[model samples]
Target: MPNIEYIITAEFHIDKGPSLVFQYPHQLPGLQNLYFLPELMLPDQIHKRNEDYTLFLLYRNLNTGEFQYLYNKNNCEPDPYFLYTIVLNLTNDEYKRGSQVKSLSILTNLSFFKNFKPVMMICLDLYFKSNDHHIIKQLYKSINEKSFIISRDSLNGMEINDISLIKKLLITSILDLPINDKIYYDENFRNKILGIGKSQIINPDLFIRKDLSFNSILNFNEMNIPIRIPMINLPDTIGDYLNPTDLNFKPNLINILNSKLSSSILNNELTIYGLQTPPIIILINAILTGKKILVMSYENSSGYIIDHILLILKIITGGGILSGLLTRYNIFPIIDVSKIELLEECDSFIAGTINPFFKNNDKLWDLLYDLDLNEFIISSNIETPGDNIIKSSIISEDARFLSNLQLSIFNYNDDLTTIQLIFRRHINEIIRILLSSKNFNNNLLPNNKDLILLLEGIGYYWSSDTTKLLEISCYQLISKKFQNLLYNEKLIYNLILPNLSNELNLMIDLHYHLQSLNNVSITTKINEREIWFNILKFLISGKSLEIFLLITYLIPPNSSTSLQSSIAHNGNITIFDKNKGIELLLINLFNFDDQIKSNIIMILQELEDNFLCGWCINLFLKNNLIYEIAFNELINT
Candidate 1:
């Protein structure tokens, strides 16, 4: 048990009397509980502030073992009662220091830990940022100044002592280390860290190693080279123009951004490329508009566009034309003589890819925020996006790593269709901001992509990535941006709306739709699924459709065959089939109580809807999966 000691937590009356009784220290605190020791020790004064009662805890001195007046201060500030949810700085300071500091600390009231002394840990959130060394040094200084080291123990309690007395402070500082000392490029170390394993003892000498290098082009680093953002969005896109009020880049790259702006949900895959491209910035003269941009080109239909791209490329203006055939694979390899074979296989028209915005300062980033790049003047058009990609190509998961050894000028990071657009729209802006970053111009490739994606997966860390750790990060915008993409009248009316295409185009459209569907809003889900079925139905007649489904295994036999079969069968709206609607409903009812497996069966049986009731039985038989969700678990062998 952690701790359940009561100090003081007086607040608005509940049942006119007391709170639940606290039995242990780590147990959850509720109504009238006298928790002896809790993970979160609030200040006594605040806890007992006339009806401001909350869970309590006792902090014992590490050296003397004497108890101090540590009580539940959770009920102190603006939202005292909701202190657990507060995002505080990782520093030992649990109290409010400022609004910008987002912390990670959890304090559990002791009620659940019956007899065992509860265990509590000070939570630390880390976000990846290149200049972590300065922050870490500050943190080390804070530790030296305020909190002391302690031999944590469940047997007794946290024993305090001078951190110096403890020899090794044991304070984890992977994300906070100086860039040179940071081992992010070390593949082995990166793998371990990605797996969330404990890092080895960082050698003091190695922690200050000046021999390491940080390269941005992936030529000699353990990370992928970032295509200079300046080259992509154009430097002047965000800078002041001649008039400061005139430019013609329509709220430009809107729909190209993550599909969440509309809240209509499209593609659960936000931040797929690791670049935090927001939807609003993709619009009509987005660079000109101070705050909002909504641009998605309604130039052509998918089928017609494919044909047109082919036609346009046939009469190439003296260069290799772009095509899916060129950038078909997922493994984008680093370019170099050694990786030539990799490039040959990709057949990409990658050529002349450069980060036109190449500098080593924060000036460009700040400039963009303060100025307008699109309004500025430029002498010539950027080398047609990634002409360098034309000269280079490879699709490998380790392209980021492999490219470190090869001086590759272009990246197959984006697909043929998406790449040209990303480059055409945002290259300059990206370059402008990137130029301002020290990490951008360093020997090391700006491996910020790795950091960004990693943070996306693990939430925050001890310290987080700088661009990612903003007040409103790109993640928050993904949903809204995606929604806006779907509703973009031009995109729908032109590309996806016409409903003119053979099965292939339809399939391509369906795949894109599916890709966007992951984040689809509830409002659009049924229609989207219907759209998928309609597309599939057009595949063939009843018997032909069944035959095709069998050949493709789109409609697998049952879950007992394989777990993935169940997942694939998820949206079973396959037409030219029986009970398609019923199966769909059963899937809606189907849910994993354990979440990983074991769909709760009763939620289906109890359904009042006839469609749900009928399909429940069939789906159960198909999956052979039971609903273990929050239900009683028992067995008799």
Candidate 2:
């Protein structure tokens, strides 16, 4: 059995923004009494105009603090019908752009002494649909009972301004803005305060420690990247089908037997013949062309910087060369066409337009002749093929021609075993090239960060001694080229944040361990903290509050029971300054989808409780972290 009503009509004014009407009732008082669309629902939307807001009046009896539910003295309108509606004339355009937040007011019709002046209120918490609520608690405080006021137009005696009406309007308006911002209820209510007329309430903890050790020395905060390990199913004791194995290492010899493709084209106008294009050049061109795949290939094939250099070369050369191109293998203008005809039969054709005229000039003709160009060009020694191939085979062919022409002055070793080892093995080729570097061969490592990172990523299990070499190389990075790049306060965070766990106990250990690393780098302490800060910053921030939940597990509010608890105990007020990181964090707060912002604020509250105290509230009262960044970020978005 339910109580049903017929048409209950009431009149209001267009004050600021749009309006929403629910058939049953609205929750928030003032303009917010219209919030009952969710709890009750006489659904209708009222839009806003000229960047203003609508104010509503929910009256209360002077003697009884309860809202007067009657509308008029005659009782046709119940005492509860004392609510006033504030509306704003808004068409679709205002809805598309923004929710014009003008001033908020209480109803002015009631008769009391027209006393104190009224103060304007701004409603900001949830957009009808956005999830960001990082500042919800702050907004609630802004409209606290002690914050707002109302008076007559003449600043004389006020007509009507009820505290209950204001409080009701504020509580409901902040709780539910344009829509239900989903974040508040998530995270098990870790970051938000609950209940009114406060007494003893539920205080629940939301995290599970991944590490159980009280005195464990593992520094979880000193970790940058998540550890990736293959998980196994079942095989004697659970085997992995997810990763690598020995059986997969065998190469496809079919590729070796097939003819390799070429890049040059001996076309109508431009001619580039017998020129070997460097792999570096190909890579560089790929970068300039925005060929991501080629850039990736270059990184895997060589070092990233070297790949970058090669990419540069490619851009400089314009689609230059590839391996095993007959057109680039020193074919003179008059050389045998018959020989090239046979090469073309293999679904491959080489072209000219490759420029290395510096080497092909008469200055190198005698040198080329001495190197036996005819042998490379014709590839025909029918009767004596076997014996000649044994002495001067194609084994060192790519190297020799490249060297004699001065295209690449690479030294070639006659050791057949070494060349054979590198033929189809990328690693072996990389090692050979590394050894070929005059500096590297002399035990001098290059001070390149990208190279070191790439080497580190190769991982120890994949290559034992080589992996050790790469790790050792990282230490050498202490030289000038690195120039303390990794030491950046924000950059060093690669050391903090556990791979997949949240535990403060681990952070303490990390702090202690980082203290030990003082011998490695005097900056270890600050670096560790900096990294941890970054992780926390990211965890508690984003378009949503997912990071906050993750961060809560790291720094729990009850961290030191013996310590003085302030609201935001670790709430370093430094970021509150404009142009600082915290300012940026606040700015991003407005952009979060309702669901995400709610979750984050709720998550932060877990630690917020331990921090919430007279001092903390005092701090919040002074926490003017809002700046140009926050305002601009929201405006731009």
Candidate 3:
């Protein structure tokens, strides 16, 4: 069966505005709403432009007892069925009575809609010239018949890692054939690379060798055309713009993250905010907590920002490695006021809209991101509760990773690949610590251990069996073996082993403590003020005070007094960067429970008021903690 659900064509009628002229294989459901059909088929401002192409998504609710496995076998609100769409517009003066705007769309169940672009381009060109119904029927038939297949039996024996790669890329299953180190390319493209005409039909199987690009051949209209699949595909990576030969264009996590950051959406973010109070971090954390985010752009309605934010969310979720983990979240690429009813039904979503009306309605969303102003407004009705240990660890790790990125940007050393490698090593350490326990498998059900272990081992080694490690799924985003080992070695020797003050150790130690359950004592000395400050920051960030208190208790009373006096003295032991100190103190003051709030306040009082002179004071004054402190002081007076 074909993954394609429909091949639809819509156009602007001068008398009637946009109308769905033809849809092969019958009409789609939910088209009865006359307003929505046209709005969907013709996106906002689509008719005004001479030529435009947009990639947007539509969704339908899952029927009862359907896609249960896809929804993680849980009795929860099911993830909506995705309708991936690509609308291509071209203006032609041939139409006499109607508007010149004509479009062709292929609505597919697969997220790998890029593969069908070649087919769509061909069919649209043919249809515009002849306006024949046969084009749609032929296009549909060819796509379904020639679609790539991953055999069910092959999928059953596959590891979770391989399954995730397939689900993420959603195009070609590179592991389908058993050949080693082979690159799949369309036969025609291979011939083109060799600078030869289709004169001789050499065995294309021999052409497959270790190469960077994976080109899938689309058989349409007796023409064999090659379509290059991108190394990474996210919700926002709608159109095709990847070049395999570009040095910065490799299919790796670092390159992908850097490419995304270089986008106009993130460029605007970086220019407006830089390192201080980055909206990207907040955007990431909001998605992590499953908050309803509304990214509103007044001037644009083409779902561009919607795609940008969705990509950010996907990147944070480990580039679709954890896409299944996001089964609870919904994505509305572009929505109008007509979909207000749909928005109300969702408990949490990351949606985009050009409608400014959504801004006034705080009840509609938890986070309102105004693209025009580059501002984020939190709904007053929302109460962001404190994070538990697990949530804290995840968010803190994210914070540290983002902080390191900012540090790199500040130092003019934006080596994103190295940074990504280090972060992966950090995660690998955590995985190893968890796997160290012999009873880890016993913690999960018999059937679930493989999945749990696979999830745990992502970005680390592919498999325990050395023989099968080389055959692990897709190569684009998977960390290579040599790079992985080199980075891990660099992390220990350069980052961790040399400097005890490195914040990375704090996290590694915490994971070790969690796995060992306090059995592993802290033998590493914590005498330096830098280490103490890092411990305090880590504890504050993680909301983990058990270790802090335990370490303090283990220290002698005189040393504790020495540490306190050291804070007040003008020695190297004292924190000189008062701005960072105040910022850290304020965050802890606000996020810590009421029981621990007083301790944070005392720490704040110990810091100098001169620290308030920096750019962070504006943030400090906006917080309620200062007001609370002032109110208490006034009452005492």
The model with the greatest TM-score is 3
lDDT of each: 0.22, 0.22, 0.43
Which of the predicted structures, 1 or 3, would earn the higher TM-score when compared with the native? 3
Give the top-scoring candidate (lDDT). 3
- Model 3, 1-637: lDDT tens digits are 4657777787776677777788879876555533465565566665555544444454443443222212222353433344444455565476566446667777664555655666777787788778998988988887766534321233233222232222222112111121112223454433332223433333231223334234556567788776544433433223322222223222222322333221222111111232233455445445434567887777754545545554444344432222432344566667778888878887667777777899889789877777666566667556433221111122223345555444434432333332332233333332232233221233222332122121121122212333123222111111222123223221111112111122232332332222222222375332222322433455432123322221221111111233334435633222212112233334444442553355444433332122212112323444456645753553354
Give candidates' CA RMSD values in order: 28.4, 32.2, 20.5
- For candidate 1, lDDT tens digit of each residue in 1-637? 2222321211112223222222212333342232322222221222212111122122333444333332122321111111121122222233343112221113323212111111111111221123122332322222223211112233443322111110110111001123223334464433222222233232111111122211112111122222111101111112111111111221122112223332222221221222222332222112211111111112221111122222222211101111111111111101112323333332112111012231122111111111112211111211112111110221121132122111111322211222222222122222112222321223222223322110011111111234333312222333233223323311111111112233233222222232233334554333443434443433432222222221121111111122223335563312212222223323433333333112223223333222212223343344434422222231111
Clashing pairs in 3: none
- Model 3 CA deviation exceeding 4 Å by range: 29-35, 53-82, 88-99, 150-213, 221-223, 229-276, 301-303, 325-327, 384-399, 407-522, 525-637
Tens digits of per-residue lDDT, candidate 2, 494-516, equal 11212112222121222222112
Clashes of 1: 158
The CA lDDT at 325 in model 1 is 15
Weakest 10 consecutive residues, lDDT, candidate 3? Answer: 490-499
